[model samples]
Target: MFELHLRQKSTAFQIEKRCKALAKVIKARRAPPWPCVPTPELPAKVVSDALIECYLRTNETLLRVLHIPSFRRDYEAVWSPDSNPDPTFLVLLKLVLAIGATTYDESFSLRPSAVRWVYEAHTWLSAPDFKHRLGIPSLQANILLLIARQATGVGEDLVWASVGSTLRIAMYMGLHRDPAGLGPSTTTPMVAEMRRRLWNTILEIALESSLNSGGAPLISLDHFDTEPPGNFDDDQLTGAEGEVLVPKPDGTFSQTTTAIALRSMFPQRLAIVKYLNDLSSRGSYAETLKLDTELRAAYKTLTRTLQTCKTPTNGPSDLELRAVDLLLRHYFVALHLPFFAPALKETEFAFSRRVVVESALRLWRAAFPVPLSQLPTIDDPLARVAISGSGYFRTIAVQASIVIAVELTSLMREEESLGLGPVEVRPDLLTALDDFKVWSWKGMETGETNTKGYLVACLVWAQVDAMRKGMVEEEWVMEVVKAAEEAETRCLGLLEEIEARGRQPQDAPFGTATQGVGGDAVVTPDFGVGDWDYMMSDVLFNTAGDPLSWVFQ
Candidate 1:
């Protein structure tokens, strides 16, 4: 049995600690025995095939967890007339299908099945003897399970801890060292390349979870000397012993191209995360500028090389471009977030605010080129998957929305002070708010971070609305205010429904209880009760009452 609760802590920087504290929700429980094999839970072959293909097309670009050709061969054997697949491979197969279900459909109709598959895979990995039996397939299963969990919103908040443990395992497996350093007898060229690829994937995911959780990254450049994967597709390297391998030309668009390009700046990104989240000693503004410059240079290299790749369609797809843009621009926002609000008051730091706002705007545009209501007609299906299937990406969108709202408030305040022309809120602000409300409604069904996100969104939206109307008591402003208020009312109602559901008693399904051993029920945070509004206010402002002044620090 387990319960989720907000951590209540006091510190010197009390407001900032309280704001960042929302990210951590601890669970109290003990492990239960692993379930039996999930063979009966497998979907039809046709359905499974479609889901796997979906995962390959959308997620495999960044995740790079599995070699496509190898996985395809294994997949074929799984359905053979007289074949028996390996147990570990079965675990990997389930995870692939679980993640595929999310990418295959934006509505996630198969989410329940996906969740079950993830839990089963997790149990297999949790066995005591599993570490003794660790191999490439087991490592692959661990990585894929993390992706599946993120896609299905299972253990979404605990990804950082899981990734940390995975990091230690990879290091213990000697993946941190380039396989070339090992004797040729120990690893073939194909195995060597796969090792490098897997290590890169592990490092990337670790950094991502660290950023999402606002924790220090477990990786540092000094901690690993593994070389980057070559620019080659899965088919280029045959798995034969003593086989020589050749990489494709730089201009060619191979499967490993994006991963390689990102690795070029992995050190800088790691430094950025460490600096942003480091509690003991953060770098100075000058150091932040240096990282900014390096990141921009790396981004430039990524675009130039990726743009030159001669695909059958002529260039990279829109989703590829958007995904890359959103990812790199997020660093731009985080790099300057500490100085953003201060820049509004001090002309010297205005550049920081400019960077934050511009980067955040670009991030928002890339993440949502079209409004949420028009999702069905979106040109790039991969973009839809990237946005809706991954909890990490959704968190980025929420952060960007808050940035937009904060900026809009500043603009309205300026207009009021100068008695200037009306400040028009960008259309994308409403687009993001609409999506926030949609997510909130979905949270009513699923019950998790989405509800809290929407509640914060509503508060920010109302505050912005008030400021806009105060600038000029106009009819249109009033209309917008009314709409914002209505959204808040609906959001509060949904929160009530969610809390009501959380209060109900339930039997243990996956060997976890809803109630404690002493008949005490699990306690859920009451949004309508004491200090809830104060918490939201703390998120929106700092102790000085300056809007959007709260950064991760």
Candidate 2:
């Protein structure tokens, strides 16, 4: 079902040319680093305050690594003309600003500075004596740095390693245990609760990082005794040495509410991640179904406020809800992936296939709310950056597109083999693939994974287009060749567009680049044909013998 043999030499050449050009753009975008100042300076008070506010709205609820009232005091002090904040606290602040900058403006105008802050934080953390300096602020800094990396797509490949290291450092600090068990030294109620919050945040990051990298979760349910944090507002916690802390009920939508809710299900979430990623623990279909049942039940138990975004005035922001929804849906996709291919050929596994498609469709909608055809010719720069700047969202979109493609192709093959006439492809699947092709452009600079995803979406989209034209299976290759030519044109156009935008005058109020738009040097020229041919082959055909295998994995 996956084999492709280009019958026409001209068709083969067209496919090769377009793919090579697209590959060239991918390489060019990766050529230059953003220009950096000799001494990185913080933005003005107003801008810095805006960044922190943005961070609080977007990230704090999810991470729950800080006691906001305490952090705010340090935040104000750093900006005070008479005070010099500790170097560690400054690093933490910069990482927070970097994360905020991604969502601060629609055009991602602060992205260059965001990248610089992450670099500076990395430099500080890499110091030989940094381990000796690890504290609550350092933990906050490291976690924020991980988040900032995901937002900016810098050091993305190393996130799994970085998260693992952070988890170990956290364990070293004894955060893996409940502070209540640590006796008089941990008697400060506010300090004890913050420790729990930070531990939960670290474990959650470790699990997610493991899922993203397809590795074993660094820590398991058995590894930690830290309790879920209270669903209390940061202001409710007094730093007085003997003050006792009390948590509000689950129905109350405080800042730590989402974190607490997620923490409540951490054990089940960890189980899902570990079972899916650990080869030795691979289980039967029945076991997978059982896990699925538990997951669904847990999801249903999530508070109504978290389950819906209808009342944003008293609950989590629409952004946070969408993010949480996508994450929960992703677990469904991951769980059923191993059986997705089998379900196409067997009746017993049909539920797996259905679950995969349903989850993917929901994810696509959450990631790109508008239909592809309805998207404006000149896209909204803010919406574009918000979606593209997030590595998590981009990954979801690409994965969803792959599932849509697989389902679309399977339907075509069934119709052809059964001589049942052309089957109408689902409209949502068609729109999703189209949107995914465009979305893939924003990620070209991040490198090979996205470029490969773009190619798959392009090829599958071509096949769907051909099917609509009543073309038989044998003629699909030629259509792919045609589509490849268009894709090359589109790729070049998008690259030119990016360069043009980079050259535009700065208008964002928060920050501006002091150097050229494309960074210190111009983008590199197109790579040779042979290099691209190798990339295509490496990506599309692996040892598994299935072209779609990598996408599923």
Q: Which candidate is the best by TM-score?
A: 2
Q: Which ten residues in a row have the lowest lDDT in candidate 1?
A: 526-535
Cα lDDT of model 2 overall? 0.68
Tens digits of per-residue lDDT, candidate 2, 1-553, equal 2334444343434554555665555445433343421132577767788878878876786878777877787677655555534556666778888887776754565666777787777766765564333456667778898988888878776788889888887776677878777675533677677778888888878888887789888676777777888778888787664567788765767888888777777777888888988878856899899999999888888746475533546877666676677778888998898899999999999999999999999988876677645765424322343354655655666678789888988887777677666667778787887887766654553223233555566877888888766787668777786666566556555555555555677464524423221113221111011111111122111223333321221
Identify the candidate with maximal lDDT: 2
Which regions of candidate 2 fall more than 4 Å away from where they truly are? 1-40, 303-313, 372-386, 418-422, 442-450, 496-553
RMSD (Cα, Å) for all candidates, in order, is 14.3, 12.0
lDDT of each: 0.66, 0.68
Q: Quote model 2's TM-score.
A: 0.82
RMSD of 1: 14.3
lDDT of 1 by residue, 81-172 (tens): 55544566667888998888776655455655677778777766776663333356677878988878788777788998899888777776
